[model samples]
Target: MEWHNWSGSVSAQPRTIARPRNESELRAAILATPRVRVRGAGHSFMPLCETDGTLIDMSDYDAPIEIAADRASAWVPAGWSLARLTETLWKEGVSLINQGDVNPQSLAGATATGTHGTGKDLGSLSTQVIAFELMLADGSLVVCDAEHHPDLFQAQRLSLGLFGVATRIRINVLPAYYLEERVEARPLGEMAERWQELAAATRHFEFFVFPYADTVIFKSLHPIAGEDEMPHSTDIDERPFRVACELGRKANFLIPPLQRLMMRLSSKPSRRVGPAWQIFPGERTIRFEEMEYELPRADGIPTLLEAIGYIRRKKLPVAFPFEFRLVAGDDIWMSPFNRGVGSSISFHQYARMPWRALFAEIEPVLRGANGRPHWAKRHTLGPDQVHALYPKTGDFLKVRAEVDPAGKFVNADLARLFGIERK
Candidate 1:
C-alpha cells in the first residue's frame, strides 16, 4: 500500500508499515528495520515521514493520560492528536498554554516540528515539554528532561523524530480557563503599522491578509475570568472560504475578484466566549499547500510587504490569505524560534494548484529577512542552508549521532538534512 501526507504533497511506499500497540511492539519494529521513520497524524507537508524503509505508526498506542497531583503537568501519549489531548485536558480541569489554529496534529509530531500558536509571551509546542520517554534506535528506552540528559532534552524537543521515537511526553499545563475571542477586519497597511502594539495588547493575536485584496482579518484571544459559555457560532466558517478557494483554483483570472468578494462578504466582526481550547483553534476545511518562515520580529512587516509586492508584480494566481503571527523564543536547538522573539509569515495555495513556483519566488524574500523555515512546511533549504541559518546545527547533529549511532532512523531526506552519508 502507498502512503501520502495530509496535504498530498509527499508520498511514500514503505517497505513495511507497523502499527505498534505497545512499547514492546514499537521496540521490536525499531530493531527490525535498518531505517525507520515514526509517523503521527501525517500533518507535516515535508518528506520527514516519507521513507522506503519501515514506517512505524504509533496511533494504536492508546495509553491513558496521567495528570500530576499538583495539576501543573500531565504525561500524555505522544500518538494522541491535539484535539484528543486538549479535550482530555479540559475534562481534567487543565489546558495547554497555547495551540495553533488546527488541532489534528499529533502531540509528538507538533513538538518535533516546533509547531506554535500566536502570542508574544508563548513559545512553540516544544517549549511546553517537560520531559520525553524515547525508544532509541537500539530499542532501549530512555527518559530525558531538563535535569536528566539535558543536552538530549534540548535537542529532542524539536528533533524532527531523527533522534528517536517519543513514546510519552510530559507537558506543563495550566488550570482550565475561559477565553474571549474577537475577530475583525482592517486594512493591511494599518494592521502592519500597529502590529507590535496590537500583539502586546492581547494574550494571542494573529492576522490573515488576502493576497490580492488590501483587507486583513485580525483575530485576538485573551483569557477571561468567567464561566465558559457555549459559543453561538464558530470563530470563522471555512465553507464559504473553501468554495472561494475552489473557484480561484479553477479560474486563475478570477482569483483577485474572488478574493475581493470573499473579504468583502466576510468582514463582519465576531465575538465568542468559550473554553480556552475551544476558542484557540479555528476551522480549516480547505486543503492547501503551505510555506511558513519565522523571521526576526522586527522584520515581519517589511518582509510581508515585500512578499505581497512580489506576488502582485508577478500576477501570481494565489487566493489563500497570508497568515502573520508572533511567537516567543526558546532554547531548543532545532526550533525555528530559537533566536529570541520571532514573527511568522505563511503563504498558502489551493492543493490542486501549482505552488512550487510561487513559493520558490517568495522564499528568497523571506530568507533575505533572516528567516528560518518551519520544519513541517514546504521549504527548499538543504543541509548547508540549514546550517547557515541555525548556529546550533552541529550540536543537534552531535546528539543525533550519540542516540542513533548506526543511523537506523536516518532516511534519505533526513540524511540530506543533516548531511549524513548513509552506511
Candidate 2:
C-alpha cells in the first residue's frame, strides 16, 4: 500500500511496512532491511518519511511513561502523540514546558524535526529532551544525554531520525498549570510594532495574517494562578473555513474579497481558560501544504512585509493565513533556532491549489533574509544551502556518518539535503 502524509503532499511506496510490538521486534526489523525510515503520525510535509526499503511504524509499541518522583521529568515513549503525552502528563500533575499548536505529531517525530511553540523564553520541543535511547543501524542501543555521549545528544535532539530510531525519550517537564487564552483581531501595523513587547509579556504569543487583508488575528496565552474549572473546547471544526478556501481556489479572483469578508465576520474577540495542555493546542482540521522559515527575530516584520507585497503583486491564489510565532534560541546542532532567537513565518496554501510556483517565487525573499527552513516544512534547499545556513552541518554529518556509516537511514530526499551517498 502507498503511504501519504497528512496533507497528501508527499507519498511513499515502501518495500515493506513493519509495526513492531516491542524493542526486540524493532531491532529485528532494522537488521532485516538495508534501508529504513520511521513514520510517526504522518504530519510532516516534507518527504522525510518516504522510503523504498522498510518503513517502521512505532504506534504499536506502547510503553508506559515513567515520571520522576520529583515531578521534574518523565521517561516517555517516543511513539506517543503529543496529545496523549500531554494528557497523560496532566493526569500526573505535570505538563510539557511548550508545544506546537497541533498535537497529532508523535513525540519522536516532533523532537527529531525541531518542532516548536511560540514563546520568548521557551525553545523547541527538542530542547526539552534530557536523555534518549537510540537504536543504531546495527541494532545496537545507546543512551545519550548532556553529560554522557554529549555530542550524540546535541545531534540527536534534532537528528531528523537519521542517526537512528529513538525508542524512549526523557523530557524535562513542569508542574501542571492553568492558562488564560485571549484571541483578538488587530491591524497588521500595530502587531508589527508591538510583536516583541507582546511576545516578552505573554507566556505564548502568535498571530495569523491572511493575504490581501490588513488585519491579523492575534492570540496570547498566559499562565494563571488558579486551577481551571471550565471545560476545554477543542475547535477542530474547519468546515466553514474549508468552504471559504474552496471558493478561493475555484474563483481565484474572489480570494481578496473573500479573505477580507472572512476576517470581518470571524474576527470577534474570544477567551478561554483551561489547563496548559488544553489551551496550548489548536484543532487543525483543514488540510494544507505549508512552508515555514525561521529568521532572526529582527528580520521577521520586514520579511513578512516583503512576502505580502510579493503575493499581492503577483496575485497568488493563496487563501490560508500566514502564521507568525517566536521561539527562543537553542544549541541543538540542526535546530533552526540554534544560537539565535527566531521568528517563524509559515506560508500555507489550500491542499488542492497550486503552491509550487508561489513557493518558488517567495523562497528567494526568505533565503535573502538569512531564513532557515523548518525541517518538517516545505523548502527547496540542497546540501550547500543547508551547510551555508547551519554552521554545525559538518559536525552533524560527521556524527551521522559515525553512527550509520552505510547511510541506512537516508532516502532520496534526505540524501539530497544531507549530501549523503547511499551504499
Best by TM-score: 2
Per-residue alpha-carbon lDDT of candidate 2 for residues 1-423, written as tens digits (9 for 90 to 100): 799999998999999999988879999989888989999989999999999889998877857789999989999999888998899889999999999998989999999999999998889999999999878999998999989998889999999999999889999999998889888899999999988888888899999999889999999999896554577887334777888999988899999998898788768898888988888998888888899999998998889999999999988888799999999998888889985898999999888889887789889999999999999999999999888888999999999899999999998999999888889
Instruction: Tell me the lDDT of model 2 at 283.
Output: 89
What's the distance in Å from true for residue 233, model 1? Answer: 5.2
| 1-423: candidate 1 lDDT, tens digit per residue | 789988888899998999888988998899887889988877788899988888988877856789999999999999888988899899999999999988888899999999999999999999999999989998889999999999899899998998899889999999999889888989888997888889989999999988799999999999997565764455677888878878888888888888888889878997788888888876676778999999988999899998998999999888688899999988888888888999999998788888898898899899888999999999988899988888999999899899888888788888888798877
Worst 10 residues of 1 by lDDT: 226-235
**Which residue pairs in model 1 clash with each other?**
none
State the local distance difference test value for candidate 1. 0.88
In lDDT terms, how accurate is model 2?
0.90
Error of 2 at 178 (Å): 1.3
